[model samples]
Target: MKTSIIIADDHPLILKGLNDFLLEKKYNVLASAVNGKEAFELIETHNPEIAILDIQMPFLTGLDIAKKCKELNWKTKIILITFEKDENIYNEAKNLGVYGYVLKEFALAEIEHCIDSVIKAMPYFSPELLSYLEVEETPKKLELLTPTELDILKLIAQNKTAKEIGELMFISNRTVEKHKSHIIKKLDLAPIQNSLLIWVKENQKHLE
Candidate 1:
């Protein structure tokens, strides 16, 4: 059976290039898409053996598509094709157990090998792509924030106390203290929550 493929990219030229490349290699071009929502529709119809996905597209991003693919338990192999080289994005892709990554610049050069490698259940990362993934462990201290802090800051304008806030947020007094410490460090404010709340409300429009 012929290997069926799909390409998802916003650019018409890029999409055409991928279609032409796959067609020249005698692969069945099942579908092509300009965005994530359209890609999802195509996947439902074609269920291609492989999908070449661009990270940044209109409506929804490729990461959203990847997440949806996982949720649906689809076994289709995905070859993420993008210009982005962010470590966080690459780590997310890896965690999703994607098959391959082909940089747009190198796709033509490495296309055939990448397809074959993925079919054999081996992961393939483009030489250009490998340098972007420098995933480091997030420090426990940095990530460690008490529930009180979260609740207080997230809904700081509610004007609740450590006791009242904890009850509302479903935490305890000790947790509240930890939250206060974390909040102090985070906002560099006085020990009181009201002033901090007012300050945050005044200056945190972007956050809201």
Candidate 2:
């Protein structure tokens, strides 16, 4: 039997596009909704195997609907589409048991694959989103460095030597080296030639 699906989005273009694509793929598109409330009603009435929802909408958000479905113990699997790459929202979706998360920029390209994974009872998150989360972790890891270590790291990013940094900060070369070592351990950076320098260079933006 063809899979039953309902797609919802506040944007007419997205709603129509996704509905049309799924129909063309020969899936049974039961309905399309323009808001979370209407989308929830469709799910309650039709109980489709899949619900493709925009993460942000009027009345209630996609995460809100997902929470409702979980509360009702419904079998409808949710695939959230959004432009947000926020860590908190992503974590909430995972906690709500959302089956798929596709960035709006890549929705049309990734929807088919996301649907397939959900049907197989597997969760799918955008690969781009994962990469973004990995990059985001660098800023958090940097928080482990003390003020002195952070100052030295920033200087290193600017291509300053330990001696130069010590002069600027009114510290001894030995003290600067000690701070560098502490930063390396705190950040869990690999022990290798200029690893600290490499890390500082790579994460220069976060220093700003």
Best by TM-score: 2
lDDT scores in order: 0.71, 0.85
> lDDT tens digits, residues 11-44, model 1?
8998998889889998888889999889978887
C-alpha positional error of residue 77 in candidate 2 after TM-score superposition, expressed in Å: 0.5
Residue pairs clashing, model 2: none
| After superposition, candidate 1 runs with Cα above 4 Å error | 132-208
At residue 11, candidate 2 shows an lDDT of 99
Query: By TM-score, how accurate is candidate 1?
Result: 0.62
- Residue 19 of model 1: what lDDT? 85
Give all candidate RMSDs, comma-separated.
15.3, 14.4
